[model samples]
Target chain A: MAKHSFSLSPLSSFILPRGDTLFYLIALFSILSLLIHHLSPVSAESRHFEGFDADEIDDFGDSDEPISAAKHIPPPPPTTTLSVSDPIESHHGPPPPSADPTSQVTSQPSDPKPASTSFEVWDEDEFEGIPQSPPSDSPLITESDTAASAESDPSLKLEPESEPESPKSISSYTVEIVCVSFLIMFVINYFTGKKENEKLALAWASKFATKDSIFDKNFSLLGVGETDDSPLLLKEGQNVFKFYASGRRFCQGLLATMELKSRHDLISRLYNMVVPCKDEITFEVYMNDDAMDHVVVAVAKKKLAKTMQKETTDLQRFASLVSPPSGKKWIAEELAVVAESKEVAGDMLNETVLDQVFGDKAYEKFGKGFISMHFSDQHLGSHKKMLVFKFALPDAKNMADMTRLVALVPYYIDLIGRYKLSSHARTKTDGARMKVAQEIYKELQNARQEALQRKKAEQRKKGEEAEAKLSAEALRKKEAKERARQMKKAMPKMKMTRTG
Target chain B: MSSPANDPRQPSTAKPYKPSPVAPQDLPIDYSGFIAVICGVFGAMFRYKICSWLAIIFSAQSLANMRNMENDLKQISMAMMFGIMGLMTNYLGVGPRGSKKT
Candidate 1:
């Protein structure tokens, strides 16, 4: 049994770790191909031309025989006769054949230039040999003279020069075309992949936040305070969230504005405070391993800022102290939860983190319809400074859901802070933990029920009061009618006595 | 009754020699270098830019391994040189008939 188990283990391991085997095979094949390439060298004999005589045999028998035959016999005689007939045929009846042939034969050699040009028109290959035709007519003509004239003719030289240059240009063009096409495809693919990743991230965030089926209206960017650099395209205290609600995609976010006593990197401090307790408990939905590196406060576009906002609802989805928003959208802005500490804890507290954590203008940086919030300096009369926390959803359709999430930001921060401070506050056992969570859930449910009941009672009271007022008014009108009738009867009697 | 020690025809065994199974360290065959050279050849032959780049990358790796691996120094250097040349020329598409020299 032991041997069998050990044998099975090897098999399982080999099957499980497939990547190693694949790499090994690839390396083996490459080495094999190389050895084959080296041991049996490829010769250039397959590519080399055997001899020029072979080309002559193939060229002469098939495609070029007519060109050769036309060169020697018919080109000269026909061309000369055609030239003579133009003058003779116009003057009188067709010249006698006897005189015509003799006259054409004499005229052919005299006008060699026209004869050669006409032969070239009949067949292109025939013109190639015509250069030698002039030389053949009188061998005394020097070789250097013919060469000079051939060089002088620009058309003759253009063909050979252009042919050699073609292959070089084609290769270059292929490289350029492949590179350009690949670049275009890469750019397009990158953008599409980025968009797909954002969508996936949003879906993952939604598990922690709100998930409302009904698409709501009234999405807007509300300016909370004053800032030099703001994402919102609005004045202080202005609400631009719902202006484009009709034509806009739905987005949700959390925005918190508070006053701070002094200028500090509050968000970094909060992160540091939580770092100690991160092992015991985790905000897995809002926090990733990379979140430590990603905490940044910067100006972003409205669409980008509201990418990670969550939908809002009355009830808490998760039984945590901080009720994370219903569903999350991609938040374009970097958010920092504010905290203040006198001394640094470890090397973790770096300058980059501090710069990323505090002092961001959420309103002006993001445009209208963004999840816009800001901190006011002048408004902090007694306090040192103000903190404005905002969360933006990418494509939020419902305004009510976003507003609800925004309303929960303060509670979320307070609960999160509380959890961080009392790391040992959790129950000892799983059963105990469950009981505590259930008790809290029950309490929240009770509170919600109580609030609903109170609203119903108030509405009932208002209805009763309105009904009473209506009946009392009717009674007063009836009483007045009775009194006027009585007064009218008395006035009539009095008018009768005084000739009324 | 057929005792080998007593038999006149039996041959005596006196510590037979055992041969080593593994090859010597100083052999010129470096698998990594040869693989790189092969990649360069195929890439140049097919005019594949990506493969040429692969050849360049593998050749760089081979060069780095030259210090550690037990390959002949001359052969390794030659392979590296050829690999690099093949990569660049193949990428340009102008070596000996559009880099068709496999």
Candidate 2:
């Protein structure tokens, strides 16, 4: 017995968990489907059941008076004989005597009339009796009949009978309520967020980009209409605004794009809560070929400066971190610089600009908003000489805080456009660029050579594999055919005559 | 420094700066990427496996030929989130209503 019990333990443990999970899953699924089915529009069968239950309950209430009155009267012999004829009728046949007086008084005094009327009332009462008599003589038959009727009709009878029990059914619809609430929240956030972003962008444009503003005096804002009263900014997307300015002294054009976070999307809003980010505006100024000398300089926050050097193609190839001039202290402890040479860094970060913009007092006011500034003459891609400035946007209420930073765009545009490299610095920059170009060319050539060699080796391997796969007899035949071809080539070409 | 316009000795007329015209290269909108995001959102909300799988496929195609990294990355991430959410809800949750009835 112990051995048998031990053997059964493994089987029970293995089968029980799976069986339990399946059973629970099926139960949950059925419950969910039933809830959905009931919540749908009322069907014909449900309407029929509702009307039938209401009428049946009223009829039973009216018949109760007659049933009580007939109980005192003596039972007729004919009614008793009819009750004993059928087993199903006999189960409720004792109640027939009570129904007989109601049929006799309401319909006719004839004996056949009483019997026929009594049978008709008892047939309807049989359906009602199934639920009423749980302890009847034949429970199996009654239980099966009650279950079949219950399956056809919903258990919603209690809903009309009692008002307080309706809340129990409502509690089961929590899933649908939650899903609908989420959809509502998403829609509300989308429209409100879009309007807010548009308001911020328009505020920025009105403050810094309109007529007589810093941008208007330095660069031309092309108007859509003939008049200058046209809008100064173009709304490109929900969160992106663009300002195109041309007619500057040294640059071809300036494209300023403000890229805000996707506040309109619910998923993006949720993601932003976990991983914090900032909205930024970038300036891309394309310079004329002769406007800039050989200089590549970048100044940024220490953390971002490292990323720029790693990610930017031109910065990675042409610039490296540089120290300040011998007697001068670095720009700021929080700042980092990457440049081709020390002179370019010095020329770019001069005394006047430093005191007005990046000094300790000014840095405190504007440092948080300032992200990075990169100026490169040998920048890769279509435009070789370019200037890029990135700044974080403050809230719309504080739009005036960035006046000094915005002014720097035109200031640097004029400074770099008019400035020229020293003779000594120019020679060094030219030589460095030439060396980088030569190294890139050499790398390309080496890659091509390696590819060619790889192809040759692949071909040789294929030939060997084919030979190895051949049978001995097939290999001999191939070799003999090759030998015959070689001998034919070795001998001088001879004219051959075929005789038939 | 004297302004050229202010100098009496110089001519009053000075040419206004006219920038050289450059060709415009307008980037086309990524319709497939946007479709993927919409499909993914529907899939997650309605628990549709086919829509979720289509979102993933369109996202891959969008990523392969991406031109702008910053903008494309944001759209791609949103699509991926909805697609994965849809798959998790369909396979790992109670599944679709039709499948449950079967």
TM-score of each: 0.21, 0.57
How high is the lDDT of residue A140 in model 2? 19
For every candidate, C-alpha RMSD to the true structure in Å:
31.4, 18.2
Score residue A210 of candidate 1 by CA lDDT: 24
- Candidate 2 residue-wise lDDT, A82-163, digit = tens: 2222234556335444333212322112222224322233335435423222111111112323445655776411111212
- The candidate maximizing TM-score is 2
Q: Estimate, for each residue in A441-475, the C-alpha lDDT of model 1 and write its tens digit.
A: 99999999999999999999998887677877787
lDDT by candidate, in order shown: 0.34, 0.65
Off by over 4 Å in 1: A1-22, A25-167, A170-316, A319-500, B1-102
Tell me the DockQ of each model, to 2 decimals.
0.01, 0.06
What's the distance in Å from true for residue B73, model 1? 26
